[model samples]
Target: MSLPPSYLPAGGPDPDGAAAGKRTYGPDFLTALFQNPLDPGYSDAAARRATEGRRTGWRRGLAGGSSALTLVVIGFLLVVAYRQTVAEEPARTKARDSLIAQVQNRREGTERLRAQADRLGDEVAALRERALGGAAIAELKDLEAATGMAPVRGSGARIRLVDGPTSVDAVTGERRTDGLVKDTDLQLAANALWEAGAEAIMINGQRLTATSRIRQAGEAILVDIRPVASPYELTAIGPDELAEDFRAGYAGPYFETLQGRYGISFEAAEVKDVTLEAATEFKLRSAAPSIAPAPSGSASSSGPGSPAPGSSTEGGR
Candidate 1:
């Protein structure tokens, strides 16, 4: 039998109509969503859960209580941790300040000691020069200059190296280290200079001696355990052809590679009247200068000004 018109879908072709037989359109999306806010699957799952809850009513209540207790415990732990951190902040701050102060004081003390040592060394040298005069003193002075035990002034080549700007990879978020100047680079440059006939060399005023060390400690480069800052300047005393020879040799090309590949800055040129400082002397308590009694009966040449060739001295270390 035919039903009432109200039972049919509104604003669309009748089901018995030919167009309705070909295709059908549902209610508007907003209207449908308002009518059934919950999805069919979610409704089914909720029904199943309700039925299971009814079956195990006591267990469901216990689980809910356990969850609430766990949340409460976690909140309490968070509160306690925040309180502890707040309480310890002052102590941590105080400790950090104390450490900074100590470091500053120690650095100042070290500077004072270094200055005092330099003064004493000058006084000792003067006394020795007065006691021993002539060829022996001259020879000793030559040895001192050769061994980097004393400062010297003359014409030489100056090499300057500077660290490049550090950049991070945009894709990988990794800091690039190749741009920074390394100890090996300094060593290579020094060797290159030496090969080109450099007699004496200094890095940022620190003289390079037989016992001198160039190494890296963490992020800093050190010469003889003393840290040197970036933009290292190397002064090498050598023949007149030193600068030209160095630039024409392997060093020039290698430095160019560094500049192109790593962005490090390099410069080499000849400089006049450049003075370099002496290396820090390491003294031994038991070491002493050996004095030769001058040939057979010869006037016992002055006193011991310096250690005889191949003999040990206080600052041998």
Candidate 2:
């Protein structure tokens, strides 16, 4: 049996043809061939498929843009880090060199100014010596000595005080600050030298005047408001027996106590031809002449009836 020709479309396969044989078709092909083109569901399905493809494309584009943005951000951060770590070294080195040069220049300027001041001071001293005679010069010398403005040299003693080695406390397991040298220690040592007939005294090249102050500022010891560090070298100009006198003074026993209790180090030795520099500056607060007043006239030498000098005798009262 053969199917009617009306069942096939134009130019379709002929069932009676010699080339006709048993043939098979896939389900997708048959579905497409028999599909209804005007169905509402088909149109809706096509629109849904198109929308899904567009959404997938949009998601892929968004993901690619985000990845590109992340890569750009990462690259920018790497550049900034490289500049900070590698490129900034030369710039910092240049700035440091500039600062060092400025400091050196300032130091040179200070040195020049100091030299000029010293020359001017010398000239003034020379002029003063020329203006004043021998007696005036002697008086000036005495004044200079009293004011600590003149350097002195003589046989005297040198005392050295140093901070003790750092030690941990056995009881508290804490570092002790008592072994450090302090301002009071320096003051006591200087006072002891003065009492021992020391004519001149210098600590760390700074001369001690009557107005000189030794004090503590935080952890530092300041002499004349200038900081000083250990080991302190105190040079005094006096007689050869100055060291012996100092050894017998209160400072010696105090220092011994400090050594025994706090472990402070101290040493004193007699030195010959010791020189002490004069103080840099001096200020006078009060001064007076040493002359005595004239004696008053005796009352017995004047007559009882005589009027006193510059006195007015009115009537007989």
lDDT per model vs. reference: 0.76, 0.77
Model 2 Cα lDDT, one tens digit per residue, 186-299: 776887787788777888988888667777787798878788899988888887899988988887888887787777788999999767778876676897875875568643
Query: What TM-score, computed on C-alpha atoms, does each candidate reach?
Result: 0.52, 0.59
Model 2 residue 121 distance off true place after TM-score fit, in angstroms: 1.6
> Residue 40's C-alpha lDDT in candidate 1?
99
Q: Tell me, what's the RMSD of every candidate?
A: 15.4, 27.2
Least well predicted 10-residue stretch by lDDT in candidate 2: 299-308
Query: In model 2, which regions exceed 4 Å deviation?
Result: 1-62, 73-109, 165-175, 285-317
